[model samples]
Target: MLGVEAQKSPKGKWTMPPFDPRFPNQNQIHNCYQNFLDYHRCVKAMSRCGQSSQLCEYYFRVYRLLCPLSWVQRWNQQIQDGPFAGKI
Candidate 1:
């Protein structure tokens, strides 16, 4: 059962985000943007509540996997420069 177990284990597998019913169409742009916002929102909320930010990593990983590197870079820069237009 080693092969079966390996398949079940997520150790070495890379994958796209699972299909989100909220963004059912072929285009994943909205999904990617939403995940990025969610990550920041989650981190912000966690900090406000005195919770650990580590719990927000799920959205971080999802956005990083789904968004283009260039877009991510631009967003990070916008955030750092205090001009990010996103709600998060």
Candidate 2:
């Protein structure tokens, strides 16, 4: 929800709005993790419905700015090797 605005494009796709500059430094690590999870869910839901994945990019951009690379890498490894596999 960070960069998801209420506006829609002519094609009815949810567009990524300009990110609020205040958001990158607004959350702690745990909050960022939750945001990442929410982002994954958004992508999964959209893709399941055959919608474009463009809306999901906002979450990625937000997380990239907020999370450390180490945390992202660890979660990525978990997705690859742990129960999170095939879920993310």
Candidate number achieving the greatest TM-score relative to the actual structure: 1
* Per-candidate local distance difference test: 0.76, 0.61
Point out where model 1 deviates above 4 Å.
Answer: 1-13
> Distance from true position, residue 85, model 1, in Å?
1.0
Error of 2 at 25 (Å): 9.3
lDDT of 2 by residue, 2-88 (tens): 232421222333434344554555445655676677677887799899997778776666565567768766776676567563345
Write candidate 1's Cα lDDT for 30-52 as tens digits: 99999989988888898899998
The alpha-carbon deviation from the true structure for residue 88 of candidate 1, after best TM-score superposition, in angstroms, is 1.4
Q: Count the backbone clashes (under 3 Å) in each candidate.
A: 0, 0
State residue 14's C-alpha deviation in candidate 2, in Å. 20
**Candidate 1 residue pairs in backbone clash:** none
Model 2: CA > 4 A from native = 1-27, 84-88
